[model samples]
Target chain A: MILVMGPVDELVTAFFLKHLTDTKREYLFVDERHLGGDVRLELDLPQGPSGKGRLRGAVHFPTWRVGLEELTGIYSRLGTGNVEQRKTPEARAEQAHAAALLDLFPGPVANRATAMLSNGSKPCQYAAILAAGLRVPDTLVGGTWERWEPFARALDGDPVIKSVSDERSLVKQVSWEATRASARPGQALAPHQFQQRIHGTNIRAHVVGARHVLACRAETQALDYRHPDMTGHTVSLRATELPEPVAEACRRLSRALGVDLAGIDLIEPPGGSSRPEDWVCLEVNTCPGFMWFEQNAGLPIARVLADFLGTPLGS
Target chain B: MSNQSTDAGLISSQDLPKLAEAGHVAAPTVGNSAAELREAVQAALAEQWSLMGIIDTGKKASDLGKKAADALTDKGKEIEDKAIHREKDARDEAHRKMNDDKAKKHGREAGAHGATTNAFARALSELRG
Candidate 1:
C-alpha cells in the first residue's frame, strides 16, 4: 500500500496516482492532527480573570483530514517550517516523530525519514556526496568576512554568495557576487553562504529505479543558475548515457543515502566535455521538479513510471 | 512493507492484483508513439510560453513605470545641458548678423551724408555694447 503524508501537490499527485497498479495498495495521507484518524487538538491559551487564568476554547488543525494505517510505504515532503509548524509544538513533534518511525516500515519508504532529515542539511549532503566518491565543487562556508581579500585574490574575482538552508535558496542566488568595493565582509554577512564559483555546464540527473535520466541546463545568465528571467536562452533535453562506473556510483549513492529516487545536479567544464569522468557532481535533490522534465523531454517520464510500476520483480 | 512500483497504473482498476499474482507486469503502451509525444511536448511548450508571456508582461510594465519615473526626475539636468549650448550659439549668430546689417546700412547712410557714417555707426556700436 502507498501512504503519502504531508504536502503533496495536486500536479504531482495526478501523475503519481496514474502509476498505482495494485488494487490492494491503498494510498493514504496524514499530517499532525490527522494521522489516518480524526483527532482534534485545541490550544490551551488561558484568559486571565480575577487574577487567575481560565482555559480558552481550543482550535484544531485547519482543513484536517486523514485515513492512515492501511498503507505500506509513506512518501513525505513535509518540512519543519512549512506545514508542520501550523500544528501545536506537541503535535508537530508528534507527527515528525511518527514519520521518523516509518523508517522501520517493512516496505520501502520513498525516503527514510531520518535519513532525509539528516541529509536534508546542505553540509550533510555535501559531505555525503563527497564521501560517495562523487565530485562536488569546492565549497567553503564561514562567517568570517575578514577572509574576503585573500579569497578574492585566490578566486581572481567576486565570490558567489548564497544561502545554505532551505529558507535561503542558492538556486536564485548563484548568479550574484560580492564585489570587493561593496562587500562589508564579516560585518554585513552573518547567515549567508559565500563560495568560490564553479564555471561549467549545469546537469540535473534524475534517477528512478535503475534508470538515470539526465537533464543538462547551461544557464549563461547573471545572478543565479535557475534564472527567473530565463527568456531567449535555449536548453535542450535528451537522455544521457552515463558510463557504467558512474551509473553504479549513482545507484550506490542512492542506496547509501537510503532514498529510492534522487535528482543529482552536476557540472562539467566546457573543456571537460570529452570525458564522462570530468563531470563534477554538484548536489542531490531528494524531490525534483519531475513535471519540468516530463514537459521538456519526450522521455514519457510518466509512462516510464507506469512501466516501472506495471511489472514486479523479474517480470 | 510499503507500496511497490508494481502497484501503480492498472488503467482499469479491475483485476489489479492479478498483475502481482502473475509476477510478470506488463509495460504500459502509453509511451510508444514518438510523434504523439512530440506533439504533446510542443503543446506543453506553447502553454508554458503563454504563461511566461503573462508573467513577463507584468514585469516589463513594472520596469517601464520605474524608468519613466527616473526619466522624469532626471530630465531637468539634460535640458540644462542643451540650453547652455543653445545660448552660446544664439549669441554668436546675433553678433554676425549685426555686423552684416551695419555694413549694408552704413554704405547708404554715408552716401546721403556726403561722408562715411562710420562715426555714427561707431556711436551706435558703443550704445549697443
Candidate 2:
C-alpha cells in the first residue's frame, strides 16, 4: 500500500488522495492536520546491519492500523513547523516520527530528507545541474558591497537578486541606486544571491521517478512567473514538449540530486538551437507544488504521481 | 525593465511579522468520535466535486455530494454547491499568492542584520557536505 502523508486540506495532498481514491489504489493517509489527536505513530529502530535493523513500526488512525511493512512507497508533503509548534509534544512527536520513517524507509520515497538538503544551497544544486550537462546562469552569492559593485557593473543587463538558499525571494533587479547605497561606510547588507538575468521562455519540467517527464511552458512577462501579480503581468501555462537531451538531463539531474520526483525550472533562450546546453537551469525543486501547473496546463500530474506511489518498489 | 522599485510581493514589509505568526497558527481539531470523524471526513471529500475534472469517475464527487445533500432533506445541494465554489475560489486565491507569501516571509527574516550572513554560512557548510 502507498502511504501519503500531509494535511488533507492542502491542495496537492488533497488532489493526490483524490486520485488514489478515484483509481481504487490501496493506500493510507496520515493526516497532518490532526496528527496530535487522530493519528499516532511509533517506530523502533536499532543500530547495526543485522536483519533486526530493518524498520519496524506502525501508524495508527482512529479505527485502522497500517504497518510499515505493508507500505511499498511513500509520498510526504510535511512542512517543518516553527519553534512554538515544535514545542507541542504530541504534534512534534508525530512529525518527527513521520520524518524518520520517510528518511529510513527502504522502499521508494518521493524524496528522502537527506536528498533534499541540496535545496538548502542553490550553488550546491548548481554543481549537480552542471554535472547533468545543463548550463546555469552566472551567479554570485554573498559578497561584500565593494566586491559586488564591479560584478554588477560588468553584467550585460541589470543583475537580479534572490535568496541564496531555498528561502523564497522574488527575482528582483537591484537598482543601481540600491547597489550604490550599500557602498556607504558601515552600512550593513544581507548576503544575497545576484545572478546575470537570462532572457528566455520559462519551462517547468516535472520529472517523476527515473523517466516520466511532464513539462509545461509559462507564458509571462513578469520577472518571476510565480508572483506575476507583483510585476503586474498575468501568466498562463500550457503543456510543452522538451527535446530528448534536455529531458534526459532533467532525469539525470533528478537522479543526481537523489530526488525520486523533481520540478526543474529551465530557461530556453530565444533563438537558440534546441539542445541541453542551450537551456539554463534555475534550480531543482525537491518538494514542488505541482497542482498549480496541473490545474492550469491540464497536465495529469496527480495521476502520474498516484501511479508512481502505488507501484511497488523494484517492480 | 522599469526603474521604479517595488516590494517583492503584494505583502508589504509591515505585514511580514504578522504573516509569519499567522502561518504558525494551528487549525482546530474536531472533538468527535472516531466514527463521526470518519463520516465527517468522507462527507468533506465531497468538496472535491467542484475541482477540475482531470479524470472521469462517472458522475464523480459532485454526484456523491448531491446524493448526500439529497439524503439530508434540506436545500442542502445548493448550499453544498455554494460552499464548494467558495472553497475553490479560496484555493485559487491561495495558489496565486502562495509563493509570494513565502518569498515575503523569507525576505523579511533574511533581511535582518546578521540572519543572511548566518544563513549563507550555514548554506556553504551544507554545500561542503
Candidate whose DockQ is highest: 2
Model 2 lDDT, residue A285, Cα = 92
DockQ of 1: 0.01
**Candidate 2 lDDT, tens digit per residue, A217-273?**
998898888867455577888999898999999999998777888999999989654
Clashes of 2: 0
- Candidate 1 residues A109-171, lDDT tens each? 555544444333466676667666677655556545566456555763456665554232424
Give per-residue CA lDDT, model 2, range B1-129, as digits (tens): 011111111222212222222223233233344334433434444443222122223335655877799789678867776765764465345534654554543444333422223355344333322
Worst 10 residues of 1 chain B by lDDT: B14-23
Q: What TM-scores does chain A show, candidate by candidate in order?
A: 0.69, 0.91
TM-score of candidate 2 on Cα atoms, chains taken together = 0.72
TM-score, per-candidate, Cα-based: 0.54, 0.72
Name the docking class for model 1.
incorrect
Measured against the true two-chain complex, the DockQ scores of the candidates, in the order shown, are 0.01, 0.05
Q: Chain B TM per candidate, please? A: 0.31, 0.29
